[model samples]
Target: MIEVHQFACLSDNYGYLVHDRASGETVCIDTPDAEACLAAARARGWTITQVWNTHWHPDHAGGNLAVKAATGCTITAPAGDSARIEGIDRTVDGGDTVTIGALTAEVIAVGGHTLGHVAYHLPEAGIAFVGDALFALGCGRMFEGTPEQFWASLARLKALPPETRIHCAHEYTQSNARFAVHADPDNAALAAYAAEVTERRSIGLPTVPMPLDRELACNPFLRADDPALQARWGCGDAVATFAALRAAKDGFR
Candidate 1:
């Protein structure tokens, strides 16, 4: 069986360590904080053998060198953003596949947050480690991609099986819920989800690793293609609706 260790680090970032029990090989999803990641792995008696980077953002890849120095783990990063990233032993594109012991992970091109942003999907494990490209109820800001490009990237994620567990990189669910409710006020599912998020946050809990099916039903960003959202946002197409919703979220608070 495959095990995933999730913990909070660097203010709002959530770090992940994926361990394959049979092989005793561990993969660090990203290096938000090198020390935190190393300690977390140590606590579990797991040694990180690989680091898979989703993007080139500082917070996402900043600790690459340190982690490599400590573990001598091979680093795999997005090919498009390789120029800005450090300690990359291999650069992979959207269709490439990476392995951790016996587990195989498909590298998905989800480049809305950054032109080189990628997601790792282990279909057999039914889990996806999405960096900043996606969130529980929201998505990363359009730092370097266009609406068309971003929407297309989201479509790829949407195509995944509903049962897949979405492991996002941040603890921004509560803040995202506020904007989600405002974006799609009439969605009862969304309203209930927001209330649940509020309750979860009130007790200092993390709201990541959300179910993809729940997100499909409640996340306004994911529902940008739905007729209701398109009509409400006054946009005819998914790309435009996504753009409008993203713009509104930028100024929501």
Candidate 2:
């Protein structure tokens, strides 16, 4: 069995340690800080054998060398931006697969926040490691790719099974839900989810790994094309609705 351990770092960034109990081997995903990753591995007595990066962002890939130096792990990243990413031993694109003991994760290109961002989907395990592509109740800001690209990427994620556990790279659910409320005040599901997230934050608990189906129902970004959301944003056009949702999220807090 594979168990996921989340390590909070760099304010809101998250690093994950996926462990395969059968082999006592672990894979660290998006090491925001190498020290934390090392400590977590040592604490669990699991050998870190691989490092998987979702993109070339410093916060995500900054600690690659340190982790590899400490653990002698192989580093893997998307091939599209390998030139920008330092210390990558293996470069893979969409449709490539990475193995962890008995399990395998398929690479899915879901760029939007960055030009070459990607996600790892393990269908048998019902889990997805999406860096900055899909968040709990929001999507990544459009830094390089266009709205069309973001839309296409999200649609690809939406095609996954409803029960897939979405592992995002940040803890932005509460803030995202605040914008969701502003985008659609009449949405009972959004209101209830926001309240729940607020409680979780108050207690220092994580509000992530949300089901994809729940995001489809409550995330304003995913509902950009919905008729009700378009009407609430004071526009019937699809692009206008998406813009309004992003604007609302930008000014939510």
Candidate 3:
């Protein structure tokens, strides 16, 4: 079986370490804080062997070199963002596959947070390590990709099995819930979800690995194609609605 260890790093980023029990191989899913990641692995008695980067963003890939220096881990990064990323042993794009021990993860192109951003989906494990592309109740800011591109990327994620567990990078759910409620006020599912998020936050709980099905039903960004959201946002299509929502979120607070 494969085991995942999720820990808080930096200020709000969540770091992940994927370990394959049979082969004792471990993979770091983005290096937010090098020391934290290294120490986490050391404490678990697991030696890191690979680093999988999602994008070129400093917070996501900044610690690659240090982690490599500490573990001699092979680094795999997205080809589109390879120019800016460091210590990349292999640069893969969408449709490619990477492995750890016996488990294989499909590299999904989920750009839009950044033009080169990618996500790692381990179908066999029913989980995806999505950087900032898709969040619990929100999506990442449209940093470098077109709205059409972003919506298309989100569509790819939507196509995944509903039961897939989405592991996003940040602890932004509480804030996102507020925006989600404002974005789709009439959604009962979203309202219920927001209430649950509030309760979770009140108790200081982490809400990173959200179920995709719940996100599908509640996240306004993911529901941009729904007719009600299109009408409410005054958009004609998914791309337009997504663009409007992203813009609204940019100025929401």
* The best candidate in terms of lDDT: 3
Write model 1 residue lDDT over 126-184, tens digit each, in one string. Answer: 99999999999999999999999999999999999999999999999988999998999
- lDDT value for model 1: 0.94
lDDT of 2: 0.87
Instruction: Compose the digit string of candidate 2's lDDT tens values, residues 1-253.
Output: 8999988988899889999998777999988899999998899888789998998889889999999998899999988767778779999888899989889999998877888888999898999999999999998887787777777788788889998999999998887887778778898988999999999999999998889999989888888879988877788766677766776676667
Q: What is the lDDT of residue 163 in candidate 1?
A: 98
Candidate structures ordered by lDDT, highest first: 3, 1, 2
Which residue runs does candidate 3 get wrong by more than 4 Å? none
Q: How does residue 176 of candidate 2 score in lDDT?
A: 84
TM-score of each: 0.99, 0.95, 0.99
Question: CA shift at 234, candidate 1, in angstroms?
Answer: 0.9
Encode model 3's per-residue lDDT on 185-253: one tens digit a residue: 888998998898889888989887999999999999999999999999998999999999999999998
Task: Judge candidate 3 against the unseen true structure and give its global Cα lDDT, from 0 to 1.
Answer: 0.95
Candidate 3 residue pairs that clash: none
